[model samples]
Target: MDKSSGTVGVFTAADVAVFSVMLAVSVGIGVYSSYLELRYRSRALRQVITGALLINICIYMSFCLYAPSLALATVTNLSTSASILIVGTICTFYITIGGVRAVVYNDVPQTVLMFLGVLIVVLLVCKETVGAAEVWEAAGEGSRLEFFNMDPSPYVRHTFFSTIVLGAFVMLYWVGVSQAPHQRFISVSTLPTAQG
Candidate 1:
């Protein structure tokens, strides 16, 4: 079983029901807007979608490679839901105020530092697990080593099909819909610089 329940469990049936409604409504709106943007030949809309897709891909890859193994009993599994809403709100606020350039500049060093930290933890995990060769063999014994070991379904992270679909949705939302990201265009000194 999932083992997560009550507060620890991110989604209950009620939550799923609400989320399903929200998702359908939001997606319908997004699709309509995207159609309008494309019909109008809106460059700004195109750029935002493209940029969001790029960001999503980067994050997804990071999760695949850097995420620590988690079971139902893991600390994060228990606390993720409580923290996620607050964290997401804060992130949105910061991004909205800081604009695109600020976000990108801040993320550059953050990404570097995050990767460094991940590297250190991975080394430590390796040391604790077994000899390097044995570790590789052990990992290979599980499907974790397989790039697409998980089922290629929407339920999984990013199947070959879902990536394009979800990635496009993410791109459209980030580029076309987000006010904060578009603010960067006007915040810049000149149109050429903003375009760049």
Candidate 2:
């Protein structure tokens, strides 16, 4: 007997409903914009979409910059809100001045640093423990190593089939439909270069 009502795994029904509405709205906007482009041959709608997307990016980036300060504040016993404000302001200043090219350039170094940090943590964990074999054993015992579950039920989450299907859909949407990737790809000198 489950104690939780209308909640499945990490998401509640309300969460699903909200996301569904958001997805519907996004699809509706995209379809409308495409129709306007095709029928009217007007770039005005496209400009509006671009402006809205830029605003969305700014808000999303602000949150991304602020999130790390929560952990930093907890560790240092400082004010999380102050840290977030400082970090967010600095990020906003750079983003406002440097623009998308700056973002693309920064992403490479940020990705490298993230991977290096993960490697260091893994090395430290292995050093303090019995190593990879023991870690694997523990993970297996905790059912964390079940990577090949091929459950065909839609109700079942994190199954191999669901993971593959969802991952493919997400990748397709992000690469083909999302404005950010579309803009980045087209910003290249030539079509062949962008395709490559």
Candidate 3:
């Protein structure tokens, strides 16, 4: 990064190399995991989850690909549909061969990339706007920080008690009783490890 221009606008060769290597490593991990895949059980729960997950994938795959497709289209001649097809195919290919194990492994790097991407955007915003402090101060001066609403009125969109209670219930349902979480839990070996 060069800040001599009063801003970090360029990605250096080292940055490119690091990003390229990280992606290559992540893909290598994913492919290696595919070779290690093993067959698992058959159950009604799995069948039901598969049907629901397919419907979700159909809807969310478009949502997930839209932003990236726009970005790719901006820089390349690739159309949005083509970009989506390429990405979707690559994703489906991995899951086809590796089962959930590949997803579990690939998720580690994907999550890292997601966080790193957000962090880079945030840092750039901070840099462009002078500093994080000023940006935060501006936000705090607005309705953004007015999160704690103690009003018990039903007309209120969000309230402190309602938020806390509903959030707790949602968390409980997802963490303890959700099929997705259950699948993750059972993915691990041993009862104690699964519980943990």
Candidate 4:
């Protein structure tokens, strides 16, 4: 996809297959972790889970580091790899000092800003293209807004069953295993406060 225009986004069948497989694997790992937590109640298993989560966070952060470099490289006419390294180093240093509390606290404003940014972009796109109706018309013409596909083949890119069922499982796994949200749920100091 082109980073500058934002008009080259494309997802092939192979992309869908890879995404589905990765989602399935993530869900499976989350389930296994939950089972281990419940059955054995082992501290070692908890530590392992924590380590795995940290590794995932680092991988995500690496990707995040690269994303901004795309824009910075275009703006400054510098090498993308160099921009990525600079941004990544700064991020690594910030994360090392900031820790989990810092991450959690920053997420609120980050989420808000992201939503506002998307809203602004969508509004601008609609304005530039004349209206939102044209956008929907184009999507419908391209058959890109399908609500359901009854295809039963597992190899199919996107079926109703695959979207609804697999999507739910993926979300459930994310919420169940992710430490940031989980910590918020358990942060109350009192049972009454938690219940409330």
Candidate 5:
């Protein structure tokens, strides 16, 4: 499908398959690397966290370089897309490497700020648009707030149940094994401090 500016953003079935394969490969790499880290019993967790941060920074830096290059030279859309995809994948790689502690500690303030910003935008949007009563009426009729809809479809992106299940899994994985989360485990001076 083309966007308003006539940019081809939608992919063919083959492209979808390729994207899926790339996603699976990235996930597999993350799982495999984590297993290696655990099995080797090497490197303090903090180093891992720092390394992940550095990796992500590097990935973003590379993209920054590419953006300038794209503007200066003639590059195909496919090349630009691939470069962006590489940056995104490397970002995930950085996260997986940084571990849980890095993710959580880094995210804590950002998450809070994100929620506040989102809430402000939502309130503004609501005030500018229909009033609360109309919003509720629309929601009740499932015009604006349906996930699975009145009827469930197998291929839908996510139902509430599916979201809960996936969210639980993600929570467990990130909280249990992430370096960012693990840092807190090791940070306490003593058991008493930890308890406090």
Candidate 6:
């Protein structure tokens, strides 16, 4: 409870319900994957059943890993302990049983769903405030929308050259060197198959 107001806390009943639902859904997905595994014992079929890499990057970036798990939990209207428990237990189970293949497969859809959630939040915010145009302007009110900053100054944070050119090199280097990407890369047989 909050000391001053005697309010219960950040997470309301609704928040708990939502978080519970999310955890339950993840558990269901895991169970379903297991069912798929048991039903199709063929190694060839299992390889095709799997997915992409580093989807956990979204989680790490969004949830900030161990230290900020509490803060991230609070933001999501979950208690710190509950958040940690849900993520830790569920992920361990999937990865343990399914291995990196499970991680990669799950990451693909989870990343898509994460973005979809963000898009929903954006739409809701726009509805609550003003239209999408106002939201766009508000984003630009800060310099976040400045993608084409052509400044050559090293001190400048987000010059077009720095973001587009340097960021490409960084991405290329990461793709080349990152263990997660390489694992995902080799999971597929051919470039065309992977692309498809």
Q: TM-score of the candidate numbered 5? A: 0.39
| Predictions: Cα RMSD each | 15.9, 11.8, 19.5, 14.0, 16.7, 20.8
lDDT, candidate 3, 102-176, per-residue tens: 665566689899999999999999999979998898898885666789998767777898888889877754553
The ten-residue window of minimal lDDT in model 2 covers 1-10
lDDT winner: 4
Against the hidden true structure, what lDDT does model 4 obtain? Answer: 0.66
What lDDT score goes with residue 84 in model 5?
62
- TM agreement with the true structure for every prediction: 0.39, 0.65, 0.56, 0.60, 0.39, 0.54
lDDT of 4 by residue, 74-141 (tens): 89978998998878787778868975456656776899999999999989989999699998899899
Candidate 3: C-alpha lDDT: 0.60
lDDT of each: 0.55, 0.65, 0.60, 0.66, 0.55, 0.59
Kindly list the per-residue Cα lDDT of model 2 for residues 1-196, writing each as its tens digit. 1244633233344533543443334434333245335433457755675677679778876677667888778788679888887777887799789875676667768999999999999888887899978878888899888778889998887999999999987885565455566444434445554334
Candidate order by decreasing TM-score: 2, 4, 3, 6, 1, 5
lDDT for 84 in candidate 3 is 75
Span of 10 residues, lowest total lDDT, candidate 6:
24-33
Q: Model 5: per-residue lDDT, tens digit, 1-196?
A: 2344443433345433443343323333343234434433444543565577569657767776677556534455556656567655766687688854455456657888989999998788779778767767767798566655433454666776667777977775455444333445454335554444
Candidate scoring better on TM-score of 2 and 5: 2
Query: Candidate 1, TM-score vs. the true structure?
Result: 0.39
Clash counts for all predictions: 3, 0, 0, 0, 10, 0
CA deviation > 4 Å runs, candidate 6: 1-64, 71-86, 189-196
Error of 6 at 127 (Å): 1.0
Q: Which ten residues in a row have the lowest lDDT in candidate 5?
A: 23-32
lDDT of 6 at 50: 45
